[model samples]
Target: MVQVHIARSGVQLGKYPEADIPVLIGAGTVRRTDHYWKKGMAYWLVIGRTYDPPAAAPPLPAASAKPVPKPMRPLRYECLRCGHKANTVREEKPGNFLMEICTWLANPFVGGLYTITREAGKKALCVNCGSEHMTEEVW
Candidate 1:
């Protein structure tokens, strides 16, 4: 039922329940560099030095073991020009520098939105040969 006080960058944030400190740390709300103090402490200590995480519990044995399923193979493509095999294709999109600069000068938010929308439309190309001509290979 102990409460812990937290401070960051020489500023005291607030006090929280001792049990919740681990959850806060796991969620990245509390940093290792932050200082913490609790009752019966002579001085504040760094959270990383003072904190001791709870041990993990042993896993329970299953009554019956099950067979593991095999993973599905990924689709592969072969470049017609270079005969190169690849599991993935690369995307290509031309950027308009003048429009981007103009929009950015007019409004940064609008420019970002316009860039995202413009970049969304792209053409898939071969990874090795950078060609649109490719044939799917079945194994």
Candidate 2:
């Protein structure tokens, strides 16, 4: 392979393989005004005039092909308190313990249903140690 020396504004950018010249042009690493020369050449010339690179290969046709769907991801989070990874505890509203116990005792079934249905929103609980503060782990 022929080795070509490249220069920009009379400053040398070092020598590179002739085949890489096209790649450098495609990647915008070299400008059309950049100068090129080889051992046999007496002087540098504008790369655009010195080299005639082959045209890029055409992209394949998409004919009747269905796009692949991305896979579903599972929910994962870390407990801020215990640093647990598996399960998360649900956060509950703060209230008087005595009052809450009395209310639960009055109607255990209804209280339990309400407790189950309560929303935690963005907050998560650590299931390992029942911690309320949870940090979500981005996949």
lDDT of 1 by residue, 1-139 (tens): 9999999988999998999888787778888799999999999989994565565677878767677777667558878888777778887666776888899899999999878876886666899879977777664
Model 1, residue 60: what's the lDDT? Answer: 78
CA lDDT for candidate 2:
0.73
* Per-residue error (Å), model 2, residue 83: 70
Candidate 1: give the clashing pairs: none
**Candidate 1 C-alpha error for residue 80, in Å:** 54
Name the TM-score of candidate 2: 0.39
Q: List the residue pairs that clash in candidate 2.
A: 88-125, 89-125, 89-126
Q: Give candidate 1 misplaced runs (Cα > 4 Å).
A: 55-58, 66-139
The lDDT of each candidate is 0.81, 0.73
Give per-residue CA lDDT, model 2, range 46-122, as digits (tens).
99845556766797787877878777565577777887776335655544446556667999986665454443223
